[model samples]
Target: MAILIDENSKVVVQGITGREGQFHALRNRDYGTKIVAGTRPGKGGEQVESIPIFNTVQEAIDETGANVALTFVPPAFAKDAVLEAAYADCQLIVCITEGIPAKDEAEMYNLIKNNTKSKLLGPNCPGLISPGKSNVGIMPHEITLPGNVGVVSRSGTLTYQAVHELTQLNIGQSTCIGIGGDPVPGMSFIDILKEYQEDEETNAIVMIGEIGGTAEEEAAEYIKNNITKPVVSYIAGVTAPPGKKMGHAGAIVSGNKGTAKAKMEALEEAGVLVVSNPTKIGKAVKEVI
Candidate 1:
């Protein structure tokens, strides 16, 4: 079973009238996601791709019994969209918009921290897919399949690259989560790791990390103490120069901290098999599993 979503999830689009929202809403619905309703301020009472639109999230939830909300609103309005979803009692909210201010993200996170029933995915992420069952975000659904491997990553394109390699080697995944490369993303590597550890369908895990933050290092420590499943990890940006931001907003090296070598060393110490090369991710997983 998937962690955050599955075949039974009733989803709603928060910015359904916009170009990106309409496009992905149709794609996700075609992939078998139960998209029950959508929200667009002045476009209420209209329909896009046959899904009814509402002026507010509460109205959409009240009318459609929507438990999941996907936000494609612009970055400036993303925080309010997320808050509206949370207040409307959407159990799971996935914000696909990128470039949201860090302070806004922090505030949105704080608003939902005490709401035990709600969970957020990303503000600059590709979202997660439980292959063969449901596709939530913009990840190419055609490349994934149902299997025993669970994959989680901080980078979106890198997550796709690793999944492609695994698929080529006939290593299908139970769930693949792109947790966003922002400094203060909604979910942490350890959070996804714990879910995978408890999932009976998952046999092994692949973690893809990049240089910049100590998230990988912290995850390694958690694995050393609590995880039992075999894990293979890949840390990107080994050749990145110090103090320069990489593609991700969070990917920056500061002196000796947050370096690729440092993260790899920590993972190795935690008994995780670390791969230095991206193309070798699948090979490393095969060796471990």
Candidate 2:
């Protein structure tokens, strides 16, 4: 019982003809995801890896009953692809394109909020994986195994690193979600946390956050008030200089706000076992569990 997707999800690729789209589509298919159809305007009737292609998302959904849309469109055209998927009523829309203008994300977010039932994952994210069940975006498939741990992270590589470490330690995960490092990403830590809290299959949780935004702080509050499961956290950018932007788009330290220390302190106060070092994430979770 994974959140967002499972074995029953029929997926459609929005930019199926492009290099990234086709590449990940094949990888996802090989990982046992149900790749039902794809959409490529002017390339309809053509196929990639034997998957049928349609000109529009509506046509693809109507023909294939695809409920999940994986988008690999360019930054400039990402919003339109997302809007098309939302308008097509795709239940889960995962956008892997990065560098989209913040305003465009905000606009698309509001449009989805007011008009559709679509739940968007990322505009600059690694996407989610339900190990041994389904793979959605760009994360490596072999690093995860099915277990009771639930992972949610804002950084893609960090998500992978943590999952790899957990797998190495024989602590498999129920779901691993990368919520993206964009300022206005589709999903939040609290959103994923709530889902994990309610999921019967999940026994523990691992939260990977970075310096920047009050997201981790808000999630800490929610955990303090609501969650009872064991939680271990790792916050990056502890050694980062203030007022400087790090690798991720949202990873910047400002004056007295969004600091790694502050986030770590908040999690600590919330009864979360906070790991100061990234490499020790798996060990920390093991201790808590």
Q: Which pairs of residues collide in model 2?
A: none
Evaluate model 1: give its lDDT.
Answer: 0.90
Each prediction's whole-model lDDT (CA):
0.90, 0.93
Top model number, TM-score: 2
lDDT (Cα, tens digit) per residue for candidate 1, span 1-289 = 8677888888999899999899999999999988899999998999997899999999998999999998999998999999999988888888899999999999899888876467889979999898988888889988887898999999899999999999989999999999998878888899899999999889999999999989999999999998999999999999988988787779989877799999999999999999888789889888888
Report the lDDT of model 2 for residue 68. Answer: 95
The sequence of per-residue lDDT tens digits that candidate 2 reaches over residues 1-289 is 9788889999999898999999999999999999999998899999998999999999999999999999999999999999999998999999999999999999999899899988999989999999988999999989999999999999999999999999999999999999999978987899899999999899999999999989999999999999999999999988889988786768878876799999999999999999978789889888988
Off by over 4 Å in 2: none
Give the Å error, residue 148, model 1: 1.3
Error of 2 at 176 (Å): 0.5
TM-score of each: 0.97, 0.98
